[model samples]
Target: MADFKSIKVTKGIKTLEIDNPTGYHLIGMGAQGAVFKLSEDRCVKIYTSPLQAKMEREALKAGQHLSFFPRLYEYGDNYNVIDYFNAPTLKEYLRNCTYIPESIAMKLLDILGEMKKAKFTMVDAPLRHIFVLENEELKLIDHVNAFKRIHPVPLKLLRDLNMMLLKESFLSRVKKLEPKTYEMWQAYFNENKMDYRNIPVDPGGDGEGVKVDSAISQTLIGAGHQGAVYRVSENKCVKIYPKTQHCEQEKDVLLSHQDLSFIPKVYETGNNYVVMEYLSGPDLNTFLKKQSALPPVVSKLLLKILTSQKQAGFKQIDAPLRHVFVTNNGFKMVDHVYSYSRIQKRPLELFQNLHERGFLDAFLEQVKVLDPATHAEWTKKPIPLTDEEAQLEIINIEGKTDSKRKKGKDQGKDRDKGRDHKKGHNRDRDRSQKREHGGKRDNGDKKNRNRSKEHGRENDRKKRSDRIK
Candidate 1:
């Protein structure tokens, strides 16, 4: 080991000055300290402050059992000796490669797993600290924040990958191999408002535009009259239009409002398609269905969207409820084809839809409390139903009236038929009783005449008998 007393270390106001009389070649320098090569397999890092040196030594000692970490050999008050990797950094190695391979992704996951096993609170490291060996092995150099800070995911590593256009490819493997870890990382990213998609600013050269590879499979997420949206990756989607002008219109609108959090980041524009950030959540229409009542936050977000559009210089300050997506941060609007070209002063389409669904009253109440000026402007004219809605209502009312009228007519016909049959039966019974009574009277008279004739003959015979006596 080199003599520590001979090496002169000076701390400046905002920098560290190292005077090496021990003939150690300078290798690396950082905010904490400077590293010098001591031998073919080892190096010494001298810190500006003893505290940082002690912290790094403890971190190295905690991870010494892991193969990825440099082996710690010796330690002092302000210096420590550890293994030196004579290899290229991960950033340098990726410059020559077309894309990140799945093997590299697996190794990165394994390194994170090792960090977790070593009880590291911060399972993250910068790409510059990661060395790629000739045999495809990875080794980490700096151990300053390995056990000091807290990070649930490898955020630095992912950000570096995104810079190199390898993040999506790496995450695809992560999703397939370690689904649970993938979900956890996604949750962390969304909570932190970090976008993980590798959106290239200039994807093509010489004005040729980027062409989507034919072999890349995409799943259709949604479709509309103007275009269709396909999810190309976990965090990226492509909107395809029938005409190039339609694609250009939406792309321009997105680019103009890129600084707005509610506007999705547009990646690239093609002849008939545009790739952008994939916002995952239910649209406002679907979200409202699951809600028992229109939450005040939703109404506020809707008003914010319109205000943002107006501020962004869009003539059409309205978006259909289906185009607005509910995200963790707030609502994000998509499909901006008509935002610039159409002349819509207010969100009438949205209000009309809410009216039909019986949510307009509640929505307006929230808006009234939130922005009375906008409420006044919106309610200045009573929101009339759309032509289609008016036609449908008329059909429904007419149908009900016609059904009731037909039912009443059928009931009256049944009552009249019943009364006519009862009157005809009573009249026939009266005629039959009269005929039987007349026949009885006629028979009684005939009997009386016969009796009278017999009585007269008896009287004559009695008178003759009396004379002979």
Candidate 2:
């Protein structure tokens, strides 16, 4: 084995070498190798571990059986360069959020199944190693601890004593640190609305809502486990529930602040179905198709929407262009299934249950203050686009239309009118379709639980007063 730094690419057809200021242009540093962007459409991974070449070969060969894995383009001298994907990682995709769309999540589950069938295990399945590329394809990178068998850790405990001690400590912490999150989860279970409780709950059903076939809408736009999105109407869309009740709650929070900015409007809703005002317009991805990055103006409008949401007391949505609707009017956020939340679990329980029972309506009825000053912090930033960038964007849009003319008739018309008023406003229809299958969050569930928890305590106090009576 030659030192990767010392080995020069000479006349071999196998290894293509380059000389640069840094020894190896770092792509990402992990347990095994360092990734590098070799070219625009290509990247290379150089293993830094002891058996760099061996691990690379093994991982590459193993990945050959899996579609989501990157194709092994070339491997030599402890370096392997393959297809370059200009998309975001799963971790980057799910910023401080949970619950993806069912359709996309199924695809991810499928990938997991394939990996399992092939006897591959990703020990550290954090969000970063998975990439969601254009064309809605999923690819896996960083395979340092892949394909290993695991031994289960079993613990035997003394039931009665352990329960008494552990119960107080755990519940005490829950009461202090994450009281709201705990209350939300308790409300969900108390009301039998555990449909979205986590992976492997009924393998995918909790019957909290109309049980729509998760597969029917699974083909909608999604990269990995985010679930599929479909076009519903010109002015509305819905996100199918992929994980939990938090999906519905996220939308509710976004809706409450509708007057603040360009967030989508929540219209009708079901256990799984949530109708929202469809945003027309191409996503930044479609608008910037083939371009490496977004122009200044488009990015500015997009950021403005995000800034507004944050100012409105809603966590920012972290998905890229796929989750955004970029229209002539501006930008609109489509998915909040994985929006940021401070509450760890069941963050949406209180708000969601309240909204369902018209409690929110009554609460807002008393409030006259709708402040825009919350978002004033954003005005200080320079606008994202320049005149030159906007002009280039318009030119690119025209060029794109011209290129699509060859597709013919209905296809061409659809492509041409992809920016039309009605269809344009219907940008996130797929999101609605995904949301329809999941059950709705019931505020009554919380109300019921609180009533139950208070019953015995209230009765005891009532008896004490009865003695006086």
Candidate 3:
């Protein structure tokens, strides 16, 4: 047996002459090691476990049959290297856009079809493992669950059911990949009397949890002590926890509410995450920066979201500003991963503290109007959003939306929008140049020629009059 801890690789481990060791820009992380960008186009995945590294190599070799996966450049005992594409992972692409487009999703189905044809299964098939390449081609990565068919094993029905559940949540994306792949795989498994023992099971949901990709999205927005927020779809945010317990707890609380518009919908949950809805526009903090001092109407909308959470009997809102996403309709409380604690006073204290700081007089008034049950605990709220109170809470954002912003560290400055602005400028310049080339250039030339002619005529007349005299 090979030592699973370490192995000395011989052929494929030559160091590229990079300015630095290279492969440090981390695109994603997993239980084993971090995946880093080798350059603008390639990536190197280093694993702590020698076993995992070898498995990665083996899978890559096997996956050569499938084109949607990365072209594995080289693999050894310590590291696996592959060519990277300019495409965003499904997790990141989902953030700014609503629903996976059929074109891309169908491509994913093609990749899945190849895997099934190889008699392989993705143990974890969440959004993270799926990448949307530049040409709307869906690529599947991280094949830790790849396996061959094994005959005459028990518990076949249960395994099939679990795989079915996974297929269901991602029905949209999966539909795009290859339609009969799953059905064909099922038939093959049944025909061979195969058991899915080698298939990795998702710990999220029930026995047959949907397979999820484990890659973290590049577009993660709000991060805090409890969890981080990712855009799952154009108008939805997936709040994932560092640990599984938090995800489970938040799912329970979110499922209790039925008003989908006021709250982002919870799609799925696992030990580490609750896949929820994402919203566009800005968080309360960003909105405040642009609008500068919330108008009464906006404040009311903000208050309405907070009050809804209050009505839902939530306590300990870790980051309230992050939870409140401002859209044209109103503010919606999008994150619930940290708010549903049984201890009610914690969130109430945060509300009172914000009120003292003048973060929300309108918010306080709305909460105060919360008939009996909700307001009963908030009596004698001493400090409101006063200067001192604001100063105090400034160090720590008190509510779920705000707390999401200031989980434990002093908030970092927002990323400069320079890159986005530059891209827009370049696009505009291209359009302007195209239009100019396609249209007439004679108007300015004609005006200039008329002026020159008038000046020349006046000069000629002066010369003629002088000669006649």
After superposing candidate 2, which stretches have Cα over 4 Å from the reference? 1-25, 96-98, 149-469
lDDT (Cα, tens digit) per residue for candidate 1, span 412-458: 22111111111111111112111100011211232366477446435
Best by lDDT: 1
Tens-digit lDDT track of model 2 for 1-469: 2234442222112122323234333344343444555556776665544465566567668878788877777777667767777777654454433334444444554565576566665422333456777655777765544644331100011111111123233334444555664475356436542222121211122212222332221112221222323334334445455544644665676656667556667776555445566565566445555454334455346446654655565543232444456655567655454344321111122222223332322322222123234223322222112122112211121234222334232222211111211223333222222111011222123335656755643554345335424
Model 3 agreement with the true structure over 1-469: per-residue lDDT tens digits: 3222232222211111112233144454454454555566666666666787787678788888677667788776778877665565555565554444666545555554466566565433445456666666666666654652222121222222222223233454443454464555446546654221211223232111123232221233444344544443445445545456656766777788856457656667665666665555555544554554436665456545555666667664333443455655566554454455433342433353343234544444565554444444443343322222223333222333333444412221211111111111111111111111111122123236657855654564355335434
- Model 1 alpha-carbon miss at residue 280, Å: 29
Model 3 segments more than 4 A misplaced: 1-23, 90-106, 123-128, 132-138, 148-300, 303-319, 325-329, 332-469
How well does each candidate superpose onto the true structure, as a TM-score?
Answer: 0.42, 0.30, 0.42
Q: All candidates' lDDT scores?
A: 0.63, 0.42, 0.45
Clash totals, every prediction: 0, 43, 46
Candidate 2 TM-score to native: 0.30
Tell me the spans in candidate 1 whose CA falls farther than 4 Å from its real position: 1-5, 11-14, 194-469
Worst 10 residues of 1 by lDDT: 420-429
Candidate 2 C-alpha error for residue 236, in Å: 38
How many clashing pairs does model 1 include? 0
